[model samples]
Target: MHGPVSTAWSLVALCAATGAYCLLRMRSGVEEQRRAAGGEALMGFGMAVMAVPAAVYAPPRWAWPVYAAVFGAAALRALWSARAGAHHLHHAVGAAAMVYMSVAMAAAPTAHHAHGAPGVPPVTGALLVYFMGYVLLSGARLVPAAVPAAGTGSGGARARWGDRPELARACRLSMGIGMVAMLLAM
Candidate 1:
């Protein structure tokens, strides 16, 4: 494979591995952790599908509609569960982005072209920017904050990173950087 295609495949592998790890973490015995892991697994798997190089496998014309329909359903589910939390909102946005990308790919003049090129259309560029920003911000939020011991309660209950696990944070950062690379490759 060429450089961009190879890189995209590498990112897809990383996403798959992250998804596996998240799935394993589901047994961590913490309800919040399980929920977070479940979400991460879904995100990772979805990203892997999105990151696949066109050279390897570009979805057929009919497949685009199917992909859009699947993601549309996911978006609808997310919308229905909007009251769940910010993660659900993010999932909804992700599903919508997938649907948009699938439709755009179907409509592209050279839909069968290789995955990464030097010039991406303005709309794809905008979407890349949005995803890059979201990934970076979300990763940053996963970082553990430092708190003084004095700030702890009388029982020494220290602040933590909450439901965000270290591996999950690393995965987010990896995907964020991967998105940047993909954007540059375009």
Candidate 2:
């Protein structure tokens, strides 16, 4: 695989790891009330995994249906949860990004002759954008917490939210760096 693809894969791996960490951090009550966080993280991980095959092989035309279904389902489910503005928006945007990537991956077989082709598929760029957005938003969510003494209100709230503010910030940055790597690869 090329450098961009490798980078993208690395980002996906990091994102997945962060997602797993989030899942582990969840409390029983929080996990039950807002399951979407874990689910979204898992989906992010899955999307990252999906990137692997597309990165290495010229995906067959037939893979289009599966790609669409998987991403579409994840997006729809995310939007349906409507957990919070940030969470919902993130999921919705991610789903749309996945749609773009799916189409790009589906067209990989004809990439050689396609107009505006890059060494990596355009979808790879889309995926990078999506994951990057995920990283940014997720990280932004942590910023209020990372800042010490921003006010006790949110800081106190972060305790109930799952994971420390500092750790959450680290996760977001890590995810963002991963997305950057993926984008670089592309």
Candidate 3:
């Protein structure tokens, strides 16, 4: 069965807000933070558009292909960036998941919408498992730990807004949860 309209609207709001925050984050002086924020913002906005309920706005036929192409490029870029660090590999996987979902939706829009559509495909299942693990791990990181304030040696009280690691992590957590919801809907 299709999800409630309110759920779709909530997702839209959440994603859009996350995107906005990421855009602000891109203003950070750190080059890497700006780059990462840019990518996260794109993903947030793209997910927001994809998550829009079909009943509210039926996308044009060409939209899914466009989604696939955009995310595919992102996936490739993430893969190329992966050599610098392991996190880029995660980004590549996330982008690839978006591509997979877009391709599936395009291949059989009707089937996806149909209650009798074939049971969860293996790829979707794998992505779900991966994202669930990410969500849990991110959630765990949010917990307040009793660690010493070593960060005090850095930008103490005058830290830039975009440099807040806690907020950035929260934004990632929001997007991860959004991904799970969108994948489940698919």
- lDDT on C-alpha atoms for all candidate structures: 0.69, 0.60, 0.87
Clashing pairs in 2: 3-185, 4-185, 4-186, 7-182, 8-182
Query: What is the C-alpha lDDT profile of model 1 across 46-165, one tens digit per residue?
Result: 667767887888766787788788888888877776787766776677667667766765766475575765576786677688778887787777766975466566576532433345
Q: Estimate each model's TM-score.
A: 0.68, 0.62, 0.91
Candidate 2's residue-wise lDDT over 113-147, tens digit each?
85773465566666677777766776776656454
- Mark the regions of model 2 whose C-alpha exceeds 4 Å error after superposition: 1-9, 31-33, 53-61, 116-162, 165-173, 176-186
CA lDDT of 167 in candidate 1? Answer: 61
TM-score of 3: 0.91
Q: Give the per-residue lDDT digits (tens) of candidate 3, residues 15-85.
A: 99999999999999999889889889989998888888888798888998999999999999999999998
Scanning candidate 2 in windows of ten residues, the lowest lDDT window is 25-34
Better model by lDDT: candidate 2 vs candidate 3: 3
The TM-score that candidate 1 achieves is 0.68
> Model 1: runs farther than 4 Å from truth?
1-3, 28-36, 109-125, 147-164, 176-186
Judging by TM-score, tell me the better candidate of 1 and 3.
3
